[model samples]
Target chain A: MTPIKGLVLAAHGSRLKASNEEVTEFTQVLASSLIDQYKHIVPAFLELAKPSIEDSIDAAVAAGCTDITVVPYFLAAGRHVREDVPEIIEERQKAHPHVTIQATPHLGVSEALKQAVIHLL
Target chain B: MTPIKGLVLAAHGSRLKASNEEVTEFTQVLASSLIDQYKHIVPAFLELAKPSIEDSIDAAVAAGCTDITVVPYFLAAGRHVREDVPEIIEERQKAHPHVTIQATPHLGVSEALKQAVIHLL
Candidate 1:
């Protein structure tokens, strides 16, 4: 039987305790909604927050997942999305060449996201 | 003559100097393009970073703007949007009842933002 893969939501972590907690909570809520096929949903950070992208990917690999999708929880396609995230993913892919690594797009202004924002407005 | 109004881009300020700088840079770019009617464009923060939202609004009021729009540079419609920001705006409005205060939506997944994200992908 083929093992089920997982999703890793990467966020630009914050040093503020409340801010980090907020991101983690959102990721947890998002992950809980998806079950059955995609079982594991992990949240990783770029800086300040714990469990960096490297750590989360390593954890996912350890949990017997052969394929992973990385979603960047960023608002813009700036330096982090343009440079930092890809570099980290590339480095990790080298280590686990067999695992299929897919880096999803950042959470920019999408329709769903726009609705969420509009609701806020 | 109707006095000029300003727009304030308020962000959840980061301690990471680079992150703050990036936000400020983006606001500057955005402000520069709107040079005709709206003159002053200021970037304020919730915490960590300097020039808090209160300070920015105060500055705008001081600078002779009779109206101001406060744009929340946040992703979700969380507590800050539902509660804190409104409270701050109310306090400021009381102080400057003559100034029209408008709080814009957060930058969620809009078509433009999505395009920006896809570009990163």
Candidate 2:
């Protein structure tokens, strides 16, 4: 089997189901585009939603992904990004020390997104 | 005086000053690029921080802006985006009906952001 890599789009979940769905919907689009790079594009939330970060990471490992990158779908590196996420990743690392779990930077100070918003405005 | 158009980056405020500062940093970069389009770029919050959405909008109007666009810096169109933001905008509209107040879409389901993440990965 080909060594698979998972790309987890981590988000701060909300009580509203629609809010959680947004991350899934976004992951679908991102997965389609990133099919070549990452085999699994999972959307995980911090709280108030399903597919908790731990569960998503487990699923990624179960799916045979040797490398997993948890990309925070956050606009800034706040408490959730700085603290909560690292705690979860640390626990997961102990569980699956073999898997190379990586967490990417939050969505702050981006020229591309800034331009996109400018064009959007 | 050149008529200013304020681009308010409406975000969910955090108790942590660093979290709120992230939006300010992002806005500074965004503002530099958008200086030609918008006269001022303000950062507003829904709760738990200074510069409430109302205050930011009021500043925009006071600064001689005829048009103001309140862009939600949210990743999802959840309760805050769907209900809280609209309610605030409606009230602001009543106060300054002359100022063309517009709310742009949230940051979910974005192709540009998706591609940016993919490239970053």
Off by over 4 Å in 1: A1-71, A75-97, A100-121
Q: Model 2 over residues A1-121: C-alpha lDDT tens digits? A: 4667998888999999988988899889888888888888899999999899999999999998999999887887778989999999999999999898989888777877786576567
Residue pairs with backbone atoms closer than 3 Å in model 2 (clashes): none
lDDT of 2 at A84: 93
In angstroms, the error of model 2 at A68 is 0.8
Q: What is the C-alpha lDDT of each candidate?
A: 0.74, 0.87
Please give, for residues B1-121, the per-residue lDDT of candidate 2 as tens digits.
Answer: 5556888999998878998998898899888888898987899999999899999999999988988999988888889999999999999999998888989987777777776676567
Model 2 residue A53 CA deviation in Å: 0.7
Task: Put down candidate 1 lDDT per residue, A42-78, tens digits, no spaces.
Answer: 8889887889999898888888888888888775566
**Shift of residue B46 alpha carbon in model 1, Å:** 0.3
Top model by TM-score, which number?
2
Candidate 1 lDDT score relative to the true structure: 0.74
